[model samples]
Target chain A: MEVLVTRQINKYFYEPEKFQVLKEINLTVNRGEFLSLVGKSGCGKSTLMYVLSTMDTDYEGQLEIAGQKLTGKKQDELSAFRNEHIGFVFQFHYLLPEFTVLQNVMMPALKQSKYAREDIRDKAMHRLKTLGVEEHAHKPSNKLSGGQQQRVAIARALINDPDIIMCDEPTGNLDTYNTHLVFDIFRQLTSESNQTIITVTHDDEFASKTDRIVQMSDGRVVV
Target chain B: MAGNRFQLTFEIAKVHLLSKPKQTIIAMLGVTFGIAMFIALVGLMTGLNDFTEDITMTSAPDIHIYKDITKPRQSILQQIYPNDMVWVYHQKPKNELTKVRNAKKIIELIRKNELVRGVAPALSSQVFCNYGPVQLNGYILGVDIMEEDKLFGIKSKMKEGRIEELLANREGIIMGKGLAQKLDTKKGDRVVITTPEGYTMTLKIVGIFQMGIGVIDNVRCYANIGTVQTILQQDPSYITDINIKLTDRHLAKKIAAELEAKFDTKAEDWETANATFLTGVIIRNIITYAVSVTLLIVAGFGIYNILNMTIYNKMKDIAILKAMGFAGGDVKSIFMIQSLIIGVIGAMAGLLIGYGLSVLISKTPFNGGDIISLDHFPVNFDLKFYMIGVVFGVITTAVAGYMPSRKASKIDPIEILRGQ
Candidate 1:
């Protein structure tokens, strides 16, 4: 159940003589497999993640997510697939500041799915309750505690029930206790659904929990 | 695919107020204020224009065929036709000269034409009315009540006595309010009227009126056409001006053209009467557009400020949404919806405030008869104003949203994710 595969993926930033971010990258992630890509700063792992997400298509790449080819697709088709199949959790939660915690979870629902109001509402409440932050559902994202906010972010990522949840440093800004709390939530999510999880991290402790480890140095995958 | 995305977009936009209702409200206030000013100013313009046209339509008959003195002289090629000159006979009262003038029946022959609705002979006398030491130099007119009313719209605008009331007696006269005041005369007041010949005749002021215009109110008196006909001692068939009435006002120029063709002379409509009125209409339109554009700029700035801030704060979200499989166009639409939300709120606020302001202005006071009048500035917020508001509102908001939407669209997802 290989969920994602990449062959000869190459991402270039500007002139190759000056700044080239990725070159000849190759990787694959299996279904229900928790994978982590560990790298130093400026190693272009984030650039690779963006290409994987279909956010930047300027790179030369043969990329597939859930066995569907991801290249040269219309912007709309890519958005639809991303909304329906892939969940994203950034280093910063990046939840709309104006929206409540429930609204943050419901953001994907509103963005992609055409469920009735009650369906999205029910799902949002359930996700918030599951994440044990139903109390923060009415509160704005910025109002929540650091650990609570990261949990809320995880809830948002899961609301769409996406096949793959890709997190870029989910606890990059949190304290050690909050970091462990967020990682524990991530472990809980993958164990419950056997969902595919891809995390890009600089921390070995966080990366060691993953089922597979891919190391990157400079612009290419080293191991 | 179902387009509930718009509802989603709108929901997001609406909650903008929830996040920062104060700022949103401040922005909307700009909208409300802009629209209110627009409505009030345009309403007053409409009211004034309506008032002017009303005065013209009520005081002057629908089709007045005065000469076009201001017209550019006919090109030599255009003047090939004979210049037809129709004699306008003025009347003389109690004199055989009128009868003798009426005796010649050739010019009266045009009365046979069915297009001629009425053929009234009129007389005018300019004399200094000595009303108990208030010597007011004013005009006095005499006309056939039935025929004159159809020509000058006299009976229709009468505030006091009926035109028939003036026609019944030889000495009956109607005076305007200002004139009535100057003469110390009212309804049923007896005033001595003297001709330019110094022949004094005591006449009863049977009516007093006001036409809402001061110039007309200050110096106007009318009596039966035949009465002045006898007094002027002119030809009976002669009217100083043959005031023509027509079936359609828009066809006035056509009728004048036909008359010019048939009579071999020139004719003009009220549009060309003063020449300055047309210029005034153009200037007023320019003023309306100028004011509306200025308000639109102010509104655009308000929306621009909000939208620009929106994109800056949502930079990471821009990256996230883009990463979530949203296109550059989608991101633009999201920001665009925000500006459009402002537009909707602003436009609605404008309409509400505009209506209130219009009503408020209708009751506003000013220096009487100095600029326009001391009365409520006439305001008619017609359909045109709303059409203007809608067009400019959408355009301005879309434009204001453009910079931010494009910036959002151009976000490099990698840089944003890396927190750069």
Candidate 2:
């Protein structure tokens, strides 16, 4: 079954005279497929990803996740759904700098779900270990290295066991070592957990490792 | 969800507080100042009021009943009141006690109130006394022979020969020390008490009294109701207007109101009885009210400024709380609580300070004599003023804090994160 699908999606920024950013893009991802969106600057990869992840919904499209229609719901619903059904790993890590690594990873599930107290902590800790950043659990998230922060982001993305994971230039700002470490976590999601991860990256090596790559130019899918 | 809200909110509020300690201190000071103003004004007004009431009681006694005779209403009063409103100043011309109206009936009515300490009918008339052609025309108050000493504080100031002689002899009269000297009459000398009706009644000087009020001291006389009643050729039962003294001075007004509504329904209170005295009280009341309002406004503004600064400083934290799904109402509550606390603390402090100041002012050692005696300045703190001050601060600050905090809450998270 297709875990995610977008048909004829069009997106625009609210201001600046409705400059269209994503135009009539159609895409589908089956269960457990690793999809990579490859593009240069301002080519709508992030815009498309924002729509597909249901974060930015000021768009015209028929989007479905796990067979539930996703349209016209308010911001609060979209936010909760995003927390529960999908996860995001932003380029900057965006791990609330005030919190510890353990707290950061537990944020999505802690906020949106009511699991057992021990289960929540265990799941958060387990994901941190899976990404091999368990030693940094108690440290402030911003103190982590670029590669380590990206790893923590990936761990946070999978902490809720979300079926789909989206990354926006997940390794765009990192050393080569951190870049490879982020990719290694992505590999673990695809092969071991059947997490359908879509990463937008300009790094060709990272793009090549995905099962299929979608290329974009000037706000549309080119090939 | 609530836990998440609290944890996030608690963290944000703490950071907000620590970030601007100076503003917080300023807000606290604002609340304190507001409270202090309320307390001081209330204390001063209440204290002055107490002092005035004390003067009225000490000088005039608890209960005074006079004839409610209709006086000619002046035409000048038509400007302030309707021409139809009858005024009273008819001087039920104090003569011998026996010539007055309903004196015994009024006394009987007064005795019904268990609180009555004494009731004495008073007869007043002007008289010329003869001491070998050096005649002095002075006022005479003919009271009950035995009870004149009990009706007022007159006995306390008796520069006397005797006050009890009214009970023993029909010719006995109590004259003032100054009047006695002026008339050249010593004790046992006879003075002819002349009636306005061209009658002569002789009285032997037996006692003298000196009230501190110079007018009352220099030209007044006291004698038995019988001495004046017999000389006037009127009914013996109809003495002058009845005077009542009560045990509790504080209950005077309540008793006065009750009596006005019951017996002397037409009579005004001594508090409101004399037109000149009433006007003075009304003026003081107006001044006190103006002072109270001004003080409250100052306090209110102080609260307002502090809360405004608090809301201004907590903008970021308010945005965060809103993003965490807190309603605008919650944001308002948080700031309101803080301001309310500040108001309460300041009000309590002001109350203490005002009370202390009132005490200090009371002990102010002018002796209340000399130049002129006004007894002592009494100070009292009324609870209503304290409550009013608290409400003023909390309410004003809360209303003041409301708009700013709401503005903070409505801030867009995306814009705030962008540091706008």
By summed lDDT, which 10 consecutive residues of candidate 1 chain A come out lowest? A11-20
**Candidate 1 C-alpha lDDT tens digits along A20-128:** 6888998888888788888898898877887887777788869898879978887778878888889888777777777788888888887775787689989989988
Predicted candidate 2 versus true structure: per-residue lDDT over A51-91, tens digit per residue: 77665557897898888788887666655666677877777
Question: What's model 2's interface RMSD, roughly to a tenth of an angstrom?
Answer: 5.4
Best candidate, TM-score: 1
Highest DockQ: give the candidate number.
Answer: 1
TM-score values for chain B across all models: 0.82, 0.67
Top candidate (lDDT): 1
- Chain B fold agreement for model 1, TM-score: 0.82
Q: In model 2, which runs have C-alpha deviations exceeding 4 angstroms? A: A1-223, B1-11, B54-70, B73-99, B109-120, B125-238, B243-266, B274-379, B416-420
